[model samples]
Target chain A: MEKYKRNERIGAIIKVLGDNPSKVITYNYFSELFSAAKSSISEDILVVKKTIETLKMGRIETIAGAAGGVRYIPIMDDMERKDFINSLCNKLRDKNRIISGGYIYYTDIIYSPELVDKIGKIIAGKYIFKEIDYVVTMETKGIPIALMTARYLNRPLIIVRRDSKVTDGAIVSINYMSGTSSKISTMSLSKRSISNGSKVIIVDDFMKGGGTALGIIDLLKEFDTKVEGITVLIASKTPEDKLVKDYDPLMVLQHLDAQKEIVDIVPYEHKDYV
Target chain B: MEKYKRNERIGAIIKVLGDNPSKVITYNYFSELFSAAKSSISEDILVVKKTIETLKMGRIETIAGAAGGVRYIPIMDDMERKDFINSLCNKLRDKNRIISGGYIYYTDIIYSPELVDKIGKIIAGKYIFKEIDYVVTMETKGIPIALMTARYLNRPLIIVRRDSKVTDGAIVSINYMSGTSSKISTMSLSKRSISNGSKVIIVDDFMKGGGTALGIIDLLKEFDTKVEGITVLIASKTPEDKLVKDYDPLMVLQHLDAQKEIVDIVPYEHKDYV
Candidate 1:
């Protein structure tokens, strides 16, 4: 076996830790992979930790004990976070995004891997200390953002379907009034999708009256799971009566006159949370 | 601004490249971020690239020209890929995973972020050299895997809906026979979801006769898009008469007897392509 250099080991450690965010990686694992001693690997980890901290890229947390290891926690510094939100709001302000029926075509941003990964890091950073077992979301548009969040948080993603199918086996279904259209609709989840008594973080792309988020909350009741938090990319201003009140919205849709193609968007200010 | 050290700059560069896999980052961007000269940043990148390659973690390709930069390409060596598949097959071998109607309850694996991330890396690694515009998948179970693949490939995800909704606006809908049960089903995609003349890689969680994959192919034709490739997590062996001819499946399901709770699973051997 070839000897490993310090720079090579540090680079590999950062890559492994970054890939598995918020998940502990034991020293033994690294030592074995690098064909090095535990003490040497520890020095390499310390170098990674100090470098990451110095650059404000992220943090490498050390967990002590028999089942302990180092974990990576992704972070977007205050300046970068503000810049990202500002740029996102600027992009959303484009008149070309306005479609019929007061809708904004922001699907491009939602699907963009670069943008969604940053969004996920910022959102997941808010709940880094929470005991979240899973990240849940409604189907279709929210899948990308929610999946990214689940990746950052190191948890599984549970998607609630708009309509149930037999391929899902037995499912628990519920009817809830749509907050945007004021029409009743059904949302379903596979009985085996989520375990009982799990703690979940509900995420969505857009929240208009919070109908879908509310439906997710109601659906989780069937499985005896608890929602630890709710987050959304954008929340409309028209629907003041949001079905779900507690949520960390990144941006707010203040006004959009589809007929005139006028729009007003602003970043959400969460006084209570990061 | 504080003076930046070589180790800190290299670590930051690695993190930035790793976070934006398959996407290029110019030296100018790094220089500006670190307040360092372009030549110094170039040297730093060379060191980082060499270190990563030495460790077999990934690649940092430096594109030369007026319109170029450094890009990261993630790789899972043969040993790691084989171990992932073997362990996955072992997990799938559990008799309790055999649900009613001969369906294997593999949702747990599908929802697992860590497992799905590795699966995405392996799948995306194959197409690292292809000109793929989008990563497409059907609604529901395949979303997580597909989303992770899209993230790794640095491409946007286009989800074909099983049922069209009002929120999607105008849509292109198609009906295809379900491969497993021989039942006709409707699959729709928003007209705005995909652009014309784009190349797409279709992915799915499971395939019983390649019906859903075929449906996606047929549906993408409506938008004048080309099918660059087709990949799936599992393809059942019973349905020998699959709708699609060319595909890159990760695993093959040889047998699934519900009453006997027997399953024969094996990793796919693709001699023609990566």
Candidate 2:
């Protein structure tokens, strides 16, 4: 095997760590990959750590144990995340985004890969040590952001469906009253999708009534799953009291007047959890 | 101002490149980021390039001119991709994955963030130079893989809804015959989802008769868009002739006997285009 230089090993190590965020990578694996001694690999890791910290890219947590190595913990600087959320809010405030149903047409922003990826990373950064078992979401518009969140968390994604399909095998379904529409809606999850006692974070695109997220929480209960946190891209400002008491939204949709073609969106002033 | 050493610069460069695959990063950007000269950044990129190529990680392309910079292009070695597909097929061959309706339970595998991310990268690798404007998928199961593919391609994602929702604003609905059920199904896309005369690739989790893919193609035509190609995770073997021709699947489901609890799956033998 060709031995890699110090720079080569550092570059490869960063790439691998970034690819598998929140997942520990064994030093033995890196040592083998570079055809170098563990001591040299250790030295390379120090350089990689400095690079990440100096750039404020993210934090690298080193684990000390038989199964320990280092894991990349994605973090958005407080000021940087605020700026990002503010910019995204600005984009959502476009007057043309107003639709007839008092809804903002944000399908373009949430479906955007680059922007969604950043949002996911930001959300994932909030719960780096939450020990989340899975990232869950209701079907349709939420999958993109949910999947991105799961990617950053290095966890599996579980999608709750609107209706159970034969392909889902046996499933758990529940009904909840929508806060916005006041209509009863059913959400389903495959019985085998999540394990009992597993902790998960629920992510979604839009949260009007918080009914969908509550429905998902109820559905997860059937499997004895625990929701670690609830996150959404946008939340309606009206009806301050949501079905779920504790949930975070990236932006607060203060008002959307389709008649006047106006959409007011502001970044959520989240608790200083970070 | 602090300056990044050679290894630190290489590590940071790879991280930036990995984060923005298929997207260019100007030398000036790196120069500013590292507080280093453009010449030093160029040398660091050369080392980064060597590390990636030597490890068969992927290919990096350098563009010249005033807009000159480096771009990371993800590609799976042909053999590595085949091995990954075969291993995924083995996992899918589980006897308990059989449901009563002749449909194999693959929700777990496809919903798996790590596995789905790899599948997306492999699919995106095949069309790196296709200049795809967007990565499209129908609602529900395909969103994870499709989102991952779009992330790697650095493009937007467009999801066709099974039914029009109030939040969709104005939509273009198309009715197409289901390939397996032979029943009429409706799919809708927001009119402003895709630009006119742009090219997109349709990605889905499963393709039984390719009816859904065909429906998406028809829906995109309403926007005067071109369907560059179609890719799926699995395709049924019985209906070898699908509604859409020239599509590719990562795996082929040879047979599924629910009674015997048997599912025979094989990795697709793709053309040696790589």
Candidate 3:
């Protein structure tokens, strides 16, 4: 006997899938929960999928096999994505965001849960099929978005530390030159943070010099981890050429005039980073 | 005409609510989307609330009046909360997690998106009705969970920096001694991060001497913000008398015999910390 009506089961199913995006939900799991046959659960998923698609929320994909299950892939459709990016660009373009040294302050935006959750989902949507093992980022501004991306991708997050700490156990420290400057700085990663030969995508809040991204890429090499892709919430327009050639940025910061109190930032065209 | 059927609307409604916990969504929003009357949306919410309650997933609370709407509150229940805390304690008990300085190496656990998400929800559940304006934490390990807490609470997060940076645009710096040691370290925050006389909760990954939490409390005082409560993922049992008397912890670290390879940790009883 079924414990819940179709609508109740559908509601609960959506809650579970929404709670855990990118993580597969087995039919048997739902079947046991509802005390219904797998066929009934599959039929209910069809309704849920149609409703979500009609609403343009995202996509619900089902895998067919013994290891297969349904997963929620957060693909903000084109119009919605464009609107979101445009709104974000507007938020970043605030005149008050320009600091004295010509640095654009968007620490609050990237630190926002709703905002960063969307940013993470968009980043995760790019590499849904890339078979990523971990979402990698350098501390500390990038941790929130990177963690959100890891959540959407259902992957672990490996945070590279600026300095080696005793709590990290065995650490690997490496020095890399700042892309836009002559100064060199060090970045360290815990040896056990990632499995060797794992695939990782680097994420950050901003890419001015690209020095930090380059440093992270070099540090990841120690673990024999493959750099699948690199992404940033925003990248500077100056230094048109970055130390790293291929990185996807959600927005491009074109101009920041501390004197005029002007800040010009725009959303970048969405492209798969991995 | 209604755009979606009853079950479909219920499914999508749950998805929307689950995606945004503690955020108010008006019936008008759903009515416009589904082209259904407010009465219909109200009835759908009834089903959602019943299903969620029956399954012990959480609660769907409805507010009655202008500027009011329905919101989801994540309540893990006593049994589930116990199970979760117990599982975490078991994970922390691994002897291999001990470092040279007796520092437990649970950074991986705290950095895990899934684990930290649950931890954040559990923490946020405690302060759901506390009228918190913001969630505050000192970077960098506490950020993931803090951001998660802020997400669940629908509030902004204020991250204290170890050192003041030009990007911060008028930073406030303070030196606080380490809880376990007499070593003093400087922590900074942007002057504009919080408004004067705001209410906040301090969150961190670990607390030994409560010096860091105290430092954050003191730092927040600079902004004239109220520290309603403080929470940490783990606290040492040795410091039965911590500098801060009223803070809460998810787990208590009883003892760690590095030489004997034994780790004693346990779940804390649930209590209203605020």
Q: Backbone clashes in each candidate structure, one number apiece?
A: 0, 0, 0
For model 3, how does the per-residue alpha-carbon lDDT over B1-274 read when each residue is reduced to its tens digit? Answer: 7778999999989988888888999999999989999999999999999999998888999999998788888776767778888999999899989888887899888878888889998899889888999999998889988999999998888899988878789888899998878999999999878889999999899888999998998888898988888989999898777889888999999998899998999988865632
Q: After superposition, how far is residue B198 of candidate 3 from its true place, in Å?
A: 0.7
Steric clash pairs (candidate 3): none
Cα error, residue A56 of model 2, in Å, equals 0.5
Model 2 regions more than 4 Å off:
none
Global lDDT of each candidate:
0.86, 0.88, 0.88
Interface RMSD values for the candidates, listed in order? Answer: 1.7, 0.8, 1.0
Model 3: number of backbone collisions = 0
Candidate 2 C-alpha lDDT tens digits along A67-137: 98988888877888999999998888888888777777888888888889899999888787778999999
Scored by TM against the true chain B, the candidates give 0.96, 0.97, 0.97
- Residue A242 C-alpha lDDT in model 3: 83
User: Which tens-of-lDDT digit does each residue in A1-274 have in candidate 1?
Assistant: 4387676777778888888999999999998888999899888888899988777777889998999989998877777888899899999999888877778888779878789888988889888888999999998788888888888899988888888866677889999998877789999998988889999999899998888898899989988899999999998887797888888899999999988888799999866444
Tens-place lDDT digits, model 3, residues A148-263: 99999989888998888887898999998988879878899888788899999999988987889889888888888899899999998988888898898989989888898888
Output the TM-score of candidate 1.
0.95
User: Which portions of model 1 miss their true places by more than 4 Å?
Assistant: B272-274
Q: Candidate 3: lDDT of B82?
A: 80
lDDT of 1 by residue, B21-132 (tens): 9989999999988889888889888889998887777788999998889999987777778889888988988888887877888888988889998888888888888999
lDDT per residue for candidate 2 within B158-258, as digits (tens), equals 99999899888888999999887889989998887888999999999999988999888888888988888899999989787789997998899999998
